[model samples]
Target: MIAARKSLDGLSAGLMLILCACWGMQQVAIKIAAPGVGTILQTGVRSLIAALLVAALMLLRGTAFFGRDATLWPGVAAGLLFALEFLCVAVGLNHTTASHMVVFLYTAPIFTVLGLHWLVPGEHLRLGQWLGILIAFGGIGLAFSAGFEEHGSTSTLIGDGLGILAGVLWAATTILIRRSSLSEAAPTKTLLYQLGVSALVVLPLAAAMGQFGAVSMTPVIWASMVFQSVVVTFASYLAWFWILRRYLASRVSVFSFLTPLFGVGFGVLLLNETVGVRFATGAALVLGGIVLVNVKRSPQPVPV
Candidate 1:
């Protein structure tokens, strides 16, 4: 049996930070490797690699693959959404800065909350949550406006829009999982559906898009592939689920806000992308709004 979960501790906090950093660095990895391996093909290949690992793990654990859980269709839909999300990531990176991609993608929570409010009972938006939605969208508008500035280009704006669409798709996947039979399935099972299906879908799509011809495997490309497949996609996801099983998910999730910050930092440091003050302010608002929307009200502890 699983042990009872506890409040966040120092070790868990530290690990969460590490996980966030790893996730934040994923776009940077993709961008770095894109020159050698076309972005879409690279993403598809990594998904394939990670799917194999997940399948092996499931096999070792004796997890049933063809269970009659009535989740197959939903699982496939989730996988499609997952594929489309990364497709946007792969293509969008070609047009936008990694910093922008990270910020826009993390907006998934906002969209998820909105979706749940309509679909799930008792998931009504609170006043603060509404305010947060307003602020977050306002920030998105402000950030998008940066495209109109002299330094911004049409491609960057398109990439930003794709980033937002990716976030929306991500949110749709989350909602489907929560509302479908997949909610009761094992985490590994859910992951397999996503990874396996994404691999199947994305690889062919990449080929159709003629992205496979750019495969020049340098050490950097190989390293990026290994990191994306092993560390970011495989290990970090498992670690996150492990953390959720052991700690208060609410407390742990709050730390995710740091991911965009880390992404922005990595972009500036590694890619030398410049962030104007307008974009910075917009990002801050988006982060603040996300925190406001997600942070739940907890009753204070009474004196003994």
Candidate 2:
């Protein structure tokens, strides 16, 4: 692998935006198909399909998977976390607007930063970083502070809780992957583990919920599933891994702040969800704080 680049070139920046767009559209796509396919079951089945696609891509690219014995345990653990993250997403989308869910889910970086400060050497944050994290969480509180008396409030609150939980799990999964022997494994293999294990793990739960029979072969469901399995799950991830290999993490992370914005935009446009000033304020802070937390500061001038 190449040493991480210290800056983002034009092409990389463009690619980052494209990938963010892909991620942003994912929730909207799933919500569109949720009527025909039970969200939870659809997620599992979609993941199963993605696993096969990823495996085939790995072979086509001459990439080996699970080649090292040391990677297995951590891989499985990360895979389970990945499954649980999306499970929350699937469940939460049923009760809340997709816009709300995306805002909360992107809080993963804050949680991950806080966890890594003490857990990993060289991962300590400056005061500015801590300030950014607090600002982000403050936005979260503001968004949910006083809406319980409103209609559908109970479901919205529950959805918010699940979305936050999903973010936490996403953070935990990142920590597991970065801290594990899988850090040295191929990106495809790491992704394969997540998709493969998630495919297996979600099946029994889907069965218990009787979600298998919920799937209908409607055009919307088919389009959504195909998009999820092909573009977002497989192509977007491969592009992400490739971009990460070529760009500085900090720069890439800053660009990722666009994802929730895209998600919110798509949700409002596609689903016709009303956005409140509170949500708008919270999303601004969330996106702003993410940019503040991830941006690489300029180096000081050389001494005389």
| Among all candidates shown, the one with the greatest lDDT | 1
Predicted candidate 1 versus true structure: per-residue lDDT over 176-214, tens digit per residue:
876678756777778778888889988998899887876
- Candidate 1: list runs displaced more than 4 Å: 1-16, 132-151, 239-255, 274-291, 294-304
What's the TM-score of every candidate structure?
Answer: 0.81, 0.83
For every model shown, the clashing-pair count is 0, 0
| Residue 288 lDDT in candidate 2 | 69
lDDT of 2 by residue, 193-257 (tens): 98999989887788899988777778877988999888988888767767644444434544565
The prediction achieving the highest TM-score against the true structure is 2
Q: Note the Cα lDDT for every prediction shown.
A: 0.76, 0.74
